[model samples]
Each structure stands twice: as C-alpha cells, then as structure tokens.
Target: MATSNGGLRNMTEGSPARHIVLFALPLLAGSFLQQLYNMVDSWVVGQYVGDAALAAVGIGFPVIFMFTSLFMGLANGGTVVIAQFYGAGELDRVRDAVDTIYTAFTFSAVPVTLLAVGLVKPILFLLRVDDAAYDDAWLYLTVVCAGLIGTIGYNLNAGILGGLGNSSTTLRFLAVAALLNIALDLILVLVCGWGVFGVAIATVVSQAFSWLYGLWYINRRYPQIAIRPFCRRFDRSLFGQIMGIGLPAGIQMSLVALGAMVVMSKINTFGKEFTAGYNVGYRLDQLAFLPVQSLSNAVTAFVGQNIGARRLDRARQGIRVTVVSSVVWSLLMAALLIPFGPNLVGLFSDTPAVIDAGAVYLRCIMPFYAIFAVMFSLNNAMRGAGESMFPMLDAIFSLILLRVPAVYFLANRFGSDYMYYGIGIGWMLGFTLSALYYLSGRWKRHGSLADRDRRA
Candidate 1:
C-alpha cells in the first residue's frame, strides 16, 4: 500500500481511482479559488469602473497568457521530471529538478517581463482593441507584466508540490491569497477608486504574497526538496531534459494564445459590448471547466509517478478513471450553466446586450465541453509519460490549423455567433486526433525516466 511521509504520498501502490480522486480534489479547489479571484477582478472593475474597463481587463488576458505560456510550459515539464524522480525514490534528483526549475524561471522572467511591458501597447494595437478600452487595457497589462515574477513563482511552487503528490498545501496558499485579493480589490477599486489599474495591482500583490509564503512553507516543511530561490542551481543535463519535453509544449501554448488573440481581434470588431460579454462568458466557462482541468492535472501526475515506478497498468487505469470523471463533470456543469448563464453574466454588467451576448456564448459552447474534457485528459496523460511532442503537434493542428481559420471564415461568412460554433468544431477535431493517438499505444514507448534507467 502507498504510504504518506511528511507531505508526500506514494501513488505507486494504491487504487488508481481513489488516489487520483484524492489528489484532484485539492487541485480542483485551488483552481476554483484562483479563478474566483480573477472573476472578482472582473466583477469589481465591471460593476464599479464601467463596461469599457471590463472589456479592457478582459482583452488583456490573452496577451498576458501569450507572454507567460512558455515559462508555465517549462514549469509543467519540471513537474513531470520531479514526479518521476519522487516516484522512483530518488530524493536527490527531485531536489535537483526543483532547483533547476527555479533557476530557469528566475533568469527567464526578467527578460520576459521587460519585453511584455515594452510591447503591451503594440500588442493591444495589433489586436485592434476598442478605442474606449485601449488605455485601460494598456494600463492593466503593463502593471501585471511588471510583476510577472510573482505569477511565475507562485505557479511553479504549486507545480513542484503537486509533483510530490501534495496538492492540499497549494490549496491553503490559494485560499489565503484569494481572500487577500478580494479585500484588495474592494478597497482599491471601490473605496480608493483606482479602477482597472487597482484590480491589476491587487492581482500582482496577492500573487507575490502566495509566492513568498509558498517559498517559506516549502523550505520549512520539505527540506528534502527545498527550493533556494537565489542559489542559482542549474543542471545542464537536467535543463536539457526539461526543455526537450517543455519547449514543444511551450510552443503549442504560444500558438494557442496567438490563435486566441486572432479570434479576439475578430470579436473586437463587433464592438466593446460584445467583447465585454465574451470576456465574462469566457471567465464563467473557465470556472465550469475547472473540474476537468484539475482532473487532467491529476492524471498527469498520477501517470508520471506510475510510469516512473514502471507500473504501466496502474497508469492506464488512472487515465481511464480520469477521462470518465472529466466527461461526467463537464456534462453536469454544462447542464447547470446553460439554464442560468444569462443571469450569471448579468451580475457583472447591467447592459441587456452584454447579458444576451454572454449567454449566447455560453449556450453555443457549453454543450460541447465533454469533447474538450476528453481531449485534455488524453493529452495530459501523454505528457505525464514524457510524450509531449505529439500532443504539441496535436494542439497545433487543432488550434492553429483548425480553430483559428474556422473562426475567421465563420465570422466573416455567417456572423459572430458562428465564432462560437468554430470553437466547438475545433474541440471536436482535437478530440478526434487525441483519441486516435491514445489508441495507437505509441505514447507508451516514450522515454520516461524509468525507461531511461532500465536502458542504462
């Protein structure tokens, strides 16, 4: 049987479903809290600042995501590396992976921050942001990018702990940060009247707090794999391994973000009302998809550990469990969201047009969420087994080759509503590709850590 030692749980010896569920619950809660604070930022800005401000904040997301996706992808690769090492009882390698990740992020974040902040206005202009929202969007993006280190630090910290099979701690960190974020949002936006800029400041401050607190906690509790932020411990070989898996994933994410920006530009032409509606609807959609995303993360860690332990059967079982649970959860959320989405969107804006557009966005896309869940689950399982290249290509094929073009063609030909239809079409294509790949069993032969050890 798997045993718990300190904060880590051994996943190699347990009922796969039970282990996965236990791990994913905290992840689910943590994701929800993270999204909650983001929603709160939009709410505070929308309710108090105005619709243009709401649209501005909304427009900034994809640009920020584009800047951060590479680092986040690398962090995910580090998680896979750490999980496999921890699973194999190689504490030293786990520490090395953690250190290497921190080192990489520390060096990379500075340039990325500088570049993002410098190009914020250009990017917004390229996206053709509405004139009314342009200034606020620039302000929000600049402030957030200036503090990019905090977001990278906090997410990487969560990734490291999650790889060690300890997700609960991350949840606590998020809960505290989420509360702090809400408080700051209310004070800065409502009382201080800082508007969209205030919301951005609150986000940066809360993220920094979480990152600092996580650093302290990790050093105090998990001395076995403690992170030394300033120590500059980079392993050339390990860095190669991490990037070998991570770079393609990063490219995939960047392309996906680019695709989103393209679509957003198209949507922007419809005016700020539609853009604001799309933003709120997308936030709610993210909330709805949290359970599936959490489950996908769980499958990645679960599969990584088992693959490291050379328990392919257990990994396969866990993947099956995750896929089913994700699909079912997606369906449940769709059912609930479809009926009440208009009212939910209304909470953020009083404009009837905004409410209707947001509701339509939800209705058009929610029912097909199961398709997305299945694709994500399968792709994450491949990532855990160190087969990132194929998934990256698959994402490129779906998001870039299919989704972006479809949205442009549809929106131009049919209307804005067809833009959502294009999204659904991309999800279906992604699922088809992912399912075929999973069935081929090619991912099983990928060069996982355990496979490397066996060959050596």
Candidate 2:
C-alpha cells in the first residue's frame, strides 16, 4: 500500500465506490476552483480591458495548452506509473518514475518555453490572428511562456502527490495560488490598468510560487518522491517505462489541442467577430466541464491504485461512479448553458453578432457534454491501467482522423453550425468506441494492481 509521511491508508483501502468518492471530492473541488481561477483572467480582462484583449487571451490559450500539453502528457503517464508503483509497494521504482518525469519533461520544457516566447508572433500569424488583436495575443503568450517551466514543474509535482493519494495537499496549494491569482488580477489588471500583460505576469508568478510550494511539500513530507538531479545515476530501464507511458499520453493531448487549433483556424476565416464569439463559447464550455475534468483526473489515480492493488471490480466501480456523476453534472450544465447562452456569451462581448454567434455555438454543443464526460473518465481509466494507446486513438479518431474532416466537409455543406455539430458527433464516436472497447473485457485482463505488486 502507498504510504506518504511514513503512514497513510492507501487511497483504495475500502469499498471502491465510497473510497473513490472520498478521494475525488477534494480533487473535484480543486478542479472547479482552478477552472474558476482561470475564468478570473478572462472575466477580469473582458470586463475591464475590452473585447480585443479578451480575444487575445483566447487566442493565446491553444498555444499555451499546446506547450503545456507536451509536459502534461508526460505527467499523465508519470502519474499512472507512480500510482502503480506506489500501490505495489515499489518505493524505489516510484521514485525513479517520478525522477524520470521530472527530468525528461523539464529538459523538453526549456526548449518549448523558448519556442513559445520567441515564436508567439509567427505562430499566431500562422493561425490567422489579425492585426487588431495580434499585439495583445503576442504579449499574453510571451509572458505566460516565459514562466512555462514553473507551470510544468508544479503540475509534475502535483501529479506525484496525487498518485500518492495526497491530493488534498494539492487542493490546498492550488487554492492558495488561485486566490493569489485573483487578487493579483484585480490589482494589476483592473486597478492598476496594466491590461493583458498584467494578467499574464500574475499567472506565471503564482505558478512559480506553486512550483516552489509543491517541491517544498515533497521534500519535507514525502522525500521518497523527490526527484534526484539528472546524472548517470538515473536508471535507463525505469526512464523508458515512464516515457513509454507518457509519450502516447502527451500525443493524445497534442492531437486534441491540434484539432482545436485547426478548428480555430476555420473560425478565424469567419472574421474577428465570429472568432471572438467562438472564444467566448469555448471558454464557457471549459468552465462548465471543471467538475468532470477534476473527476476524470481523480478517476485515473483511483483506477490506477485500485488496479495496482488487484481490485478489478473496484476499479470498475469507481469508473461507474465517474460516469454517472459526470453525466449528472453535465446535464445540469448543458441546461444552464443552453438557456442562458446569450448572458454567458455577452459576458465577453457586448456586440450583438458576436453574442448571437457564441450563443448558437453553445446551444449546439451543450448537450454532448455528457458524452464528453464519459470520454474523459474512460480515457483516464484506461491510462490508469497502463493502457495509453486508446486515449491517443480516441483523440486521433475524434480530432484529426475524423473530426477535422467532418468539420471541413460539413462546414462547406451546411454552414459552420454543422461544424459545431461535427465536434459533438465526433466526441460521441470516440466515447462510444472507447466504451465498447472497455466492455470487451480487454483492459481488465491486461493487468491488475495485485499483478503489479507481485512483479515488484
């Protein structure tokens, strides 16, 4: 059983359903709050700075998510390995996995950081960012990218903590950082009149602080999970194991983000008002999925630890709870978004055309949120069991393989409304395919938590 600070119940030591919920609550809350924290940047900027500024932030997100996605993919894979190793009582292997994730991702992070900062202008131009908003987008992306490593570090460390069932600590740390972000956003962006640059700097500053805090927590309370400096002391076999898992996971996110970038390019062709409206709709959708996102992450660790412990039934139970709970929240949110669509979109833009376009997009896509919930949870569950290829496949089929083509052809045929519908349909396709794959009883027999322990 995994133990942190010398003695702690492994996260899945009880009834699977109850334990899953207990473990997930803190993470769920943190996820919601963190999403809220993100919303603060847009809300503050949109309300105070103006539509162009808000649009710039929106344009910057895909680029930022693309950079973070690389590290995040590695971290997702690392977290799965850490959980399995921790649950299996392989402390040394757990340490090794954590170290590999820290080292490899950090090395990759530095170059990506430089690239994001240096190439922000050309990158945005390639995405068709217009002259009016290019300056703000470049400014936002540059400052955020400057501290990208700090963001990556904090996420990587937090992944380690989550694997160890110490997610409550991550929740608190993120809460503190999010609060600081809110305060700084108000002071710098709203009160001080620094604009988008201020919001960007504040985000990076808080991320740096969180990175330090996470590192401090690991060193003080969980030294075993501490990542050693890279040297020949690093084990090649274990490094390979972590990378084997993480690379596909990272590719999964990259594909999804890449697809979004493609769609954003299409949205760009519609002119600034439409692109701006799409941004509003997308941000609101992100906000709405906060609970499911947090729960999906929790599901990964929960399923991983349980599977590591040889509790197959329990893993399935946790996944069931994930599906049902996520669907419930999704239904509630979709209802809210569909009805109050204008109010939500108008939060960003006062113009009627932009508001109408955003409202239509939200109404078009809201119902599929439940299917998205399923896809998110099941993909995480699969990854937790050390099967990452499905997620990559899921992202590929939905986004690149199918989604891109669907949007392109459908947009040409039935207008962009069909393009919006295409995203939802493709998501459903992936979700349905993944569900059938899981039910086929393959991932279950592939391995178990007990099997991992025996290997150790």
Candidate 3:
C-alpha cells in the first residue's frame, strides 16, 4: 500500500512515461474536484440567487487569485524541495522542509487574512466592479478572505504529499471535500436560501475539512516528523532554500494574476455582458486545460525526483513524454470544445448575448491550448531542476509584458473577439523561451539546494 501510494517509490528506476501517467491520473482527479469547489458554488448561486450575485462572485475572483499566489509559490517550492530530498533518500531533510512550509503558512495566514478582509472593498472599487454588484461582492469576498487559512492549509499539505508522489491521498481528500461542498451548496442555497453567503460558507467549510483530514493523514503516515510547534527551530538556510525557489514562483504567479486583473479591468469597461462572458469562458477554459496543468504537476515531481537521484537523462526523458502527452490531450480537448462550445457556455447563462460572447472567447482560445500545454510542461520541468528564477522571469515576460499589452492593443482594434488572443501569443513566446533554455542543458548543474547543502 505504501509503495502504491508513491511515498516510497524510486521513480528514477521506472519507465518514465508510465510513472508520469500514473502519477498524473490522481492529480487530474484532484484538479477536477478542486474546480468543483467553485463550480458548485457558482451553479447554485446562478440558479437560486441571480445574475447579480453570480457577477459579484465572478468579480471577486481576481482578488482571491492574487492573494493566493504567494502561498502557492511557497507550496510549489516546498514540493520540489521535498521531492528532491525524497529522491535522494534524504528523508530527514524532507521532514524538515515540510515543517518549514507549515511554519511559513501558519505565520502568514492571519496577517494575510486580515489584510484581505480589510482591503476587499477598496480593491473591488479599484477594479471598477459595478455598483449593482458591490454589496454581494463585498459579502462573498470578505467571507472567502476570512477563511484563507483553510485554503492555504490544504494547498500546503497536498503539495507536500504530491512531492512525495502521493497524489492519490490528496485526491481522496479533495473528493471528500467536493462531495461535502455539493451537499452544502444544495442545502444552503436551495433549501435554506442562504444565497451567495451560503456558497462562501460551503466552500470554506469544505476546504477546512480537507485540511483537517490531510493533517491527520500526515501525522499518522509520518509519525517520525513532528507537525506541531511548526517553527520550533527554524533552520535559516533550509528556509532560505524554500523561499529562494518559492518567492520567484510567487512573484511569477502574482504577476500573471495582476496581468489578468488589468485585462479584467479593461473588460469591465464594456459592462456586465462582456464581463460575464469573459469570466464564464475563463472558468471553462480552466476546466478545458486542466489535464495539461495536472500533467505539469506530474512533470515537476518526475523531474525533481530524477534530478535528486542524479538522473538528468531520466528527467529530460520525462519532459519529452509529458510534452507529447499534454499536446495530444489538448488537441482532443480542442476538438470536444469546438463542437459544443456554446452549449457548454449556455450552462452558465441563458441570455443569448452572454452565451454568444462566451462561445466566441472559447472558439478563439481553444485552438491555441496546445501552446499553453508546452509552456507549462517546460516551466514545471525547469522549476523541478531548481532553475526557478529564470522561469519566473520568463512567465512574467510572457503573461505580463507581452500578453497584457497585446490584449489592450487587440481589444481596441478588433474588439472583444481578440481579448483572448494575447494569451495565445503569450503561450507561444513562453514556450519558445522555456524550450530553448531546457535544450541548452544549463539546468543540469542546478539540481537542488538540499543536495548542495548536504555536499557542503
């Protein structure tokens, strides 16, 4: 059972493609469940609450996404560090890295929570959220921000386990959370008429439950590592290594969100129909591209473990396999989306104008989905190699520098039909750079800080 969990598996010796596919399956499932958290809430609110409520929820996302980017960076960094340590049979360091991440999240949670709650209104104003949607947006945003700890906790736990190649366990936890979220959504929104507030409550409660379960699982599974007294004895160097990899990741993610916010702000000028269409289409885009994103996580783990085992060849081979797999899955997704794009968009809104806007966005973006797949695969592989700094810069250049500028330029000339075009262009540029860097083989020397520390 432990072996099957991937907790003790030596990925360096296995067939790279098989291991990657096996690892990604559970991650893919977890991603679906994760998306379900928001989807359930949106579905219930759209059906029971009203379009204004839905718009409020939608408008609040950029704020939520921006704040979460920091923690995600730390989590992703910790995941790679732990995977490398595990791959190298450095179990002690793995334990230390996990504890360090928990410490970081615990320390940041309260301050960030307070800040998010306090600034929610101002941020919404700055985004130019419509007056009609302001109050409901305030309610949903405040509640969600107050519960940031739950979301941070779950991501940290899941990320560490995933680094150990134990995505299956996280999948189980997410499944439970998704089920609870659905039940809560139905009861709170449909029966009790709790509306948007109920949706927020359901999401928070379900996420909190998932975090609790992960805490229990981690404690029982690795009893040797103490989970309490999180920052009992902070190892500055070790923490530095984590932050070294994580901060850039955080900046990269935040920059991307910032860019999206900029574009969203621009879209807001066109009024609610365009906003609704863009936001709804973005949700479907996330779901459509989920497979590639999941595979990116798989690639990160594969590369980290292999590099830690001193098997650069295997790590490179894994990237090759991942890129091909992601491209194929993306093409399949594009095909499915092309046929039923409008019908799927219709699920979120019955209004013909909103539906038309969403369908146009999907059709323009779906063909270029493969570019995103390649970009993620390469970036994640580089991240696993401890070459995170450059990748972060690359992402910012692509997502922010190129993508945002292109959006405004295209929006002015071609109208909303071209709003998503910049994203495709960004993907192409990001992939080209990442691929070149990888082919240069410069990352070979950058195994991981944990390995370097041990050698020193």
Candidate 2 lDDT over 149-218, as tens digits, reads: 8788877877877777667777777887798888999999878899999999889988888878777766
What is the lDDT, from 0 to 100, of the residue 83 in candidate 3?
83
1-456 in candidate 3: lDDT tens per residue?
225432544577779988888888898999998887777676677667876787788887878888888998988988888888878888888888877887777777899889989988788877887776778889999998998888888888877887788788888889988999999989988999989898889888988898888888778876754465355656678888888888899889888888888887787777777777777787888887888988899889889988888888899899999999999999998998877888987898887777887788888888888878888889898898888888898998888999899888889989988777877888888988888887888877786555698777
Candidate 1 lDDT trough over 10 residues, lowest sum: 447-456
Query: Each candidate's lDDT (Cα)?
Result: 0.89, 0.78, 0.82
lDDT score for residue 42 of model 2: 79
TM-score of each: 0.98, 0.93, 0.96
Clash list (residue pairs), candidate 3: none
Residue 305 error, candidate 3, Å: 0.8
* Model 2 lDDT, residue 90, Cα: 71
Task: Please give the TM-score that candidate 3 achieves against the real structure.
Answer: 0.96
Task: Please give the TM-score that candidate 2 achieves against the real structure.
Answer: 0.93
Candidate 2 colliding pairs: 307-449, 308-449, 309-449, 309-450, 310-449, 310-450
